[model samples]
Target: MPDGDVNAHRRIPRPAWDVINQLALRRCTDETHSVRFRRGSEITRWTLAELDQRAVNLARRLHATGVRVADRVGVLSTNRIEWVLLDLAVLKLGGVTVAVEPGRFEPERVIEKYGLRRLFAEGETSRDAVQDIDSVLSLTEPPGTDVPELPAFPGYDEADICQIKQTSGSTGTPRGIETTAVSVNSSISEVQELFRHGDGDNILVLLPLWFLQQRWWFYSALVFGHDVALSGYEDAVEMAQAVSPTVVMGVPRLYDDLRARIRASGAPVDLPERRETIQALLGGRIRYLWTGSAPATRATLEFFNDAEVPLYEGYGLNETCIVAKNHPGAFRLGSVGQVLPNKTIRFDRDGVLVIASHHPVNTRYTWCNPGDNQKVWLPTGEIKTYDLGHVDDDGFLWIHGRVDDVISPSAGPNVLLPPIETLLRGLPGVHECAVYGRAVRFLTAIVSPNPDLDPAVLSDRIVALNETLRPEQRVHAVIVAAEQFSVRNGLLNTQFKLKRRQIEERFARELELVYDKHNGDAAPPVPPVLVFG
Candidate 1:
């Protein structure tokens, strides 16, 4: 992806932070109510003035510790108001911040590779992960730390790398994506304008602060003088009753779980009244719902649509920023909405989606695996998104599949994963599964059945589930995996996500026999090297 010509993207720009910083100051002095953090039975809030003063105190502490401009820092913690304040404090000092996903983050590797000036984690995090660096400190001070007076933060500019997003790689480790201050500010502005976000909106925060989908909303709330309601991962329907948020956003899993829970209750999922009941469970004031990170389940989407819930889908990566999104008056299911305003999209000769925008985007990578750089940012200021997709005649983008996810064989239709994997996950006896159809005779899958069920019985259940599929979509054979993909097994990313390519490699030999049996002239013997029941 090359910048080609930036004519379509050029806009008169100012740093988004400085402008929003001023807004925070104004709101604080006006005593405007700003944030609400939820605990078991308590909803604590802070006025802009109180929030500003606390942030200033934290900034002074950071400065006291010799934090300075242009230094890279790492944050490994969960979502909280303090996370945003620390992030803003970093930006104020012209330092760069990196998010380390706590569940799967390798703290020591990040500290060495990024040469972090400091690392911040929740006090509750394992001491082993925090290590013994003087730079490793709790995100906030305990009862005994002293604070001295300090001057106001001078703030940063386009040249300063304000944040680094660690992209999980196929190999299980992650590479850092550097985002400049200008890029972040412009993204905040664009998202605010696109969503028509204003000061009056009460946003319900669901995703963790480390994720771009959630992190940007925190920035938006600060910029627009809105309120944020932090909810934990639980029954969102129950959580909504506590917060009464006007908008809710999360990954596809959050909604999928809600749909499953509703169906289990024997409630109707298709009728208009049922949709309203689902919405009511979420505090009854949701203007629209939004999901990203992965494709939404068709069942979840259809369920919400019948309930008249507007669920928008978006597509982007850390390197490319927000590429395209579905929104009001312009949305299509199975499509990732329209190309966002001011962004230009085109497909390469290889059918890979390429995005170009003039807003000061990320320029380079830090600690990327070999050959991964080709898929990140290029010299042309364009992002080479390896995701394969094309723009429709109506200007919407539909993802075809990843360049590496294809399972093309000698004489059958190719199989694309996720769609296959997600379907398998819905079957009763199936606990976990993955599909591989590349260069084989037909589609085959590796499965981990529920632990409580008999192995042969579960395999038979999968065979029955396969009959519900079309010829190309059907799984002709199933390999029973010895265990579920997990962090301990080195198959799941730190975020507990499947590193599909890695999983395939780990089971390469086992799959060869599975595919051979499905397409072989003779009934193939069960894999001897594996624990196939």
Candidate 2:
């Protein structure tokens, strides 16, 4: 354990570990209805004791296959009972579990980064890139065989590494973010303190457990001895009704989709019966909703407020494990809450956010690339967050956008593209917009105009709208015919964050022509320039 020196993040104490172990043991006994999930039309329930024993069995099997303490084992599957089982088993045996996001598998990179010795798949489709793995294990029964029996393993210490989560890799290549058992326990404790839960609480999980954020909720519930309800990829209304969870965690977009669906279906968004059901599940649960992984829009926040359900929003990254959250007594509708207890947050001269907390710091895992640390750190001890935001007078935090996207080249004053785009996207004719500056001189916008609007009218209206901006911030021209930004098109990342560099690279030729036209070079004699729209 690192000493609590000014230079080092403090380590977890022994008593915390003991408490976690005892909690896990007690919770294991209550597993009779600990987990409930649906397979087609069949509903399966498992007690906490059953889950514990299954994890022990899986741990023994994994150890027999040469897994050891600190070794990385990868699970590439969707959310299911087996996923949690394998995860707990790995943790119990002192092995680190790395969850592979569905549809975002990079086999070669996984092997190279994590040195995974064993890989588990839920189905054959998930084994598409299994060639790099040393051994592959199936969670379900093989074609003609029953599920393989796993052996039990000896006990594990609380200080052992539990999981190594890969960063979302929105900026560059991904790197393994190591999380120790003690840190996970601390995170779980923090959650239990803020969001009260008990054995009677029934929680619903919809976000992919592979995400570090969602995993916190899972462990928190488990630590609090709460029952967990799992659902397949179903519509929001079905999930809400079937799970009847008192507490739910979802991304901003998911909440938006749910609100839209509930409204469109004309279902009672906040029926008293459903509210009471949710409240009972959380042991008098006061709040039933939370949004993260991206900014929650004012419209989405107000939707829940109007429906009379308590929805709190928070902000964090894989590195810090949810440092700030909005609690029932400390929530502001649009803010991402205040800086959490025992954490310090500050801003640099350029307005980029920085965070320093008790969470473990990874000196070896380089997720952001060769110069990532330099980009996210200053000469001071704080870690550069890359996010741009400010704390309000009342201590609420408001994240504006990424500092990288808000560029100020020597040619002009600062230009914040994201905020501009946010406003533009809300305009009547605009569908989506990506604003970027090129060659340090001109500003350009790659826009996907609303399909329902007339193209000629939209183009003309957009041109007229640009006149409202200062000349430097004005759009040089609008690329109106471009397709909607998507991951498959190399325009969005796995987290649905826009890939600005990719979009710029894809539109290089058109940008060059635009630059030339502005610089007095002969303009290309073309109209309705497609530019691979």
Candidate 3:
């Protein structure tokens, strides 16, 4: 589709490579001393020209190692200047960059599945893993290795595939999603329109760069000639105070942590002066705050809304590259926003959300198998999003949960798990809760109590929490497990999201006993020998 017709449901225009090139050229000539970081006793500044040169050098070095166009080069490192440089370098070489989120996956698992040939590490610890790579490039000069230093290289066309980011794989195995320079440019345009970003705007990037959404914020700011402030390994609160960014992007957990910190500091929650301080600190110059990667809780939304900061919650997957997003002007508290101009959305007979957009939906770097690909239909040549949601009366889109996760029993209507889980997590003393309907009559819960408080206190808290829940939505009883749900235990995927199927299967026997007892079909067997911390 031509760029102009992207919204008209036509083919997306050819990729635009000049966007980054122009930024580099202008940075070389004009802005020589833009401050990138500002913390007490630690300040860093870089000119566009310097960044361009470094990116070119990194690209040249990568190509010298026999990397070619469309090759999947994995980068496993923390957020830093090198991470950005490697991304730009990959774009310059027309290679696909697969960024691994920190602390999410085992090194061996990442290598085995992704077939990573080359890797860039931030330190020795990261470099020690992944033995299959032909070469290891250290951004921080880890000791005792023959890895080459980054070099300068030339640029490539904007139409080239720049990055191949893996899906969060919160529910299943991770799949690489190919994003072309053209699609990225389209994404930038979409964000610019959605957020109304313009020149002189400062976008604070608090989330990790490996997250595809954060990449959108970075590109959008750069394409619009807005200043980009990056926080490296700093706490979210400290970053906010130091950067004083006009725009901030975060997940629900990040916002919740910030709110908790603010409240714990004895700051008056309802004071007008404190509210103004927060607005200026986080949104003063900021026009909007964006949250996603998971659904935002009502409490998080209310906290920000009461502070007068517009929280634009969006919805997308790696496969589609942000098909839907809420705009500041068209904000809705519980909705993920309307479909993007270039996309079409509708519900399947089962209430699964589907999307159709102009960009090519699949690429060689990441191939959705026949089974999975079949779920994303091109009935009218539009890619169907497999999520479950509905367009409300006001034309806003509200996502309930995944279609596959809707639990229906012979006794009643299907129960959506996400909303219920969100409500449960919001209750006092509840750390994390996973809801799954087992057998026919019972909804079971596997809960983790907050370690900071006593178990006796948590039990009382859960009782109070139950009062706020609908009877059917409430868990019959809670199991205070010693271990937290995590990817390492196969209970969660790398994105820190619950893997319901895995959790259920792992504890199937215990759940069966619970179900049989509750239904009065049989006497309850002895409780499983589960340990509690």
Instruction: Give the number of the best model, judged by lDDT.
Output: 1
lDDT of 3 by residue, 1-533 (tens): 11122245355544333454443333343352232654346756666545555566666666666776667677777666666767766666656778877665666666666766666654434343343221333421233234354334354455566666766343455556666665666666677666666666677776677876676655554455566777742455566666667777776666665565565566665757656766755645656677887788888787777777777788876666677778766877888887776566666566666665565434333544545544454535445555677788877888877766677743556677888788767755555667767446646666655545355655565566556766555555455556766556777554446777777777677666666566563422122212242
For each candidate in the order shown, give its overall lDDT on alpha carbons: 0.66, 0.62, 0.61
Cα lDDT for residue 127, model 1? 52
Better lDDT candidate (2, 3): 2
Q: Mind giving the per-residue lDDT tens digits that candidate 2 earns over 122-176?
A: 5443343342221322421222223344434343455455677877545556656
lDDT of 3 at 64: 63
Clashing pairs in 2: 31-47, 31-48, 32-47, 32-48, 376-384
Better of 1 and 2 by TM-score: 1
Span of 10 residues, lowest total lDDT, candidate 3: 522-531
Candidate number with the higher TM-score (1 or 3): 1
Clashes per candidate, residues 3 or more apart or on different chains: 8, 5, 19
Ranking by TM-score: 1, 3, 2
- Model 1, range 1-533, lDDT digits (tens) per residue? 33246455466444334543443233344266467775447777876556655555566677777777677767777766666677766655567777877765557766777788777766544353242322322433431356554545455555566778877754456777777666666667666656777666778886667765576666566656676777655545666787677788776766766776676677773587787777777877788888877777666677776578878888877776777888877888878888765577777777777777766466667668777777567667677777887777898888766776766765657666777787776665455577767665566677765554465665566567667766566666676777766656876543345667777788888777666556654432222112373
